[model samples]
Target: MLSVHEITELSEEFETKTPQEIIQWAADTFWPEIAMSSSFQTQSMPLLHMVTSLNRSIPVFFIDTGYHFWETLMFREKIASEWKINVIDLYRDHRWDVFAKQNIRSLPLEDPNLCCYLHKVQPMQKALKDIKAWISGIRRDQTSVRAHAKILELQENGLLKINPLLNWKKSDVQEYMEEYNLPAHPLYEKGYKSVGCAPCTVAIGVNDDERAGRWAGRGKVECGLHTDMFSKKDIADVQNEFHLDITKVK
Candidate 1:
């Protein structure tokens, strides 16, 4: 129950603390009420290893976007099994099934934002509704939108969003993963620097930004989970961003 002002103050102080220290504080402060989300990508290894190492019981939310690459799903299963992690699978609500099925092929290319909203954002919103805090594996150097994010963000719904790896960079992730002998996503070496749903993701050159492969050439960067889209509770609030006419979605 931290006040907004208090959370802001603490977030500033956290910039000087190690990610592990920040994670430990979050675990101590909110154990059962807290959870973390992972996309099961190569870059996500460090945060996943650190959190589960500290406490194996912390729930991990994995959005099972039905459009994921088969390798991503297999890698996720391998990691969860080997680490004995408490991984929870999240899926889009049944209400969107008919609409989703109808536009299965065109949805991603026609309106990726809406597709992500239905698959990734909405499922995570529903999964996190009962949680007090959410730990995410985003780093500042990954994207321009994430560069300005704080270590702790208090959502409009009062959920505390914690980003322990906010200050970490691509090199830091690589170094930590190597040091800990963490497993990489199967497609990591295949030039899939940043993996997402099949249609939106592509392989990129080695020197490119780690996330350059995600939603390339789509004029879309984020999947809406880390954006203002997450704050909107209803479809009406985000209908303007969609290429699909969602007014008749019922």
Candidate 2:
């Protein structure tokens, strides 16, 4: 693996390379240690296509909250078939118990943030434990928080995050998918630009639908996995408040 300075230099050079070149570089360098996480969103088409095109066997971890839309599950299977990717499913083992204790079933009805904490974020953190690098299809224009996302990042947990398409625009993703004749998830045509759990994700009109329905009136857009899901300060606070050891949740 390259040193931090070496990584920065190579990352600058990587900007001009095509998607295939980047994937090959990752495959040759990271090899079996690299993996991807996909929510099966239509916007993910380009990255998924690129990874599959490289013909490398990389694990694609899917967080199965068991609350996803049926269409999402179908799309997951479809992509796995097309790409022949190694599929790894993750679910919170105590999900049912936690949901029962917390009474979280639907969208805003349940604390969507905690629901994501117990289901998606917790499982994802554990599933990614051995992975040194993670690749995601995040783009700059997706949200305010992502505007500064780099092509590569050193995550809080020391995981190397590769956002090869961080520079891509929504139109860029659409164009690549169309050019490659990639089949889009059926939900995209239904006006769902951002896909998540079925209840939290409802169709919206194209006009200023900046993830409007996600977590609905709760005003919470993240599942804690992306945001404070596991911040160092927040973890310390939680541990102090609960009078519990840190390793329990981690």
Worst 10 residues of 1 by lDDT: 241-250
Clashing pairs in 1: none
What's the number of clashes in each of the models?
0, 1
lDDT at 176, model 1 = 99
Task: Evaluate model 1: give its lDDT.
Answer: 0.90
Best by lDDT: 1
In order of appearance, the predictions have TM-scores of 0.96, 0.85
lDDT of each: 0.90, 0.73
lDDT of 1 by residue, 42-76 (tens): 99999999999999999999999899999999999
Q: Model 1, clash count?
A: 0
